[model samples]
Target: MDIEEVRKVASLARLSLSEEELATYGEQLTRILGYVKVLDEVDIEGVDPMPHAVDLQNVFREDAETESLPREDALSNACKTDGQYFQVPQILDQKD
Candidate 1:
């Protein structure tokens, strides 16, 4: 592609570029497109597209409920706490 086309692409991608950056990207994109054009000429008679290079299988275990730590131990480091639970500022408080 030409430098003008590269500038347009940079605009569409929401990228800011100086004149030097535009020139650099223009050359890079041109070379990349040239390489892709060369690849387009290759023959692939028996090739198979891959989801992944290796075979894969699903492997998951059943979920199970588990108990959490005792409330006293869990809340031991709290800045402040009521008898049974940690105290935090209310989310809906206007001061927040």
Candidate 2:
């Protein structure tokens, strides 16, 4: 890709790149696209897309609450609290 095209992409992505960084990314992206182009040459008549390379299953346990702190104990760490609730600046309430 040309430097101008690369700059345009950087603008769209909200990126600020110095001249060196821009040149580096431009070269790297061009090389990646060239490799992707080569993959199109491969013929896979009966190949199927796989979720994993090896047989695997979920090993996670079911979600269950083991223990929970009391409301007063949980609120003890807050800088400001009104009994049980935390005292935070209400952004939405001030919008009107």
lDDT of 1: 0.87
- Residue clash pairs of candidate 1: none
lDDT scores of the candidates, listed in order: 0.87, 0.90
For 1-96, candidate 2 gives per-residue lDDT tens digits of 888989999999999999998999999999998888987888877998787998678789979988799899999999999987999888785866
Q: Tell me each candidate's TM-score.
A: 0.43, 0.43
| Total backbone clashes of candidate 1, pairs 3 or more residues apart or in separate chains | 0
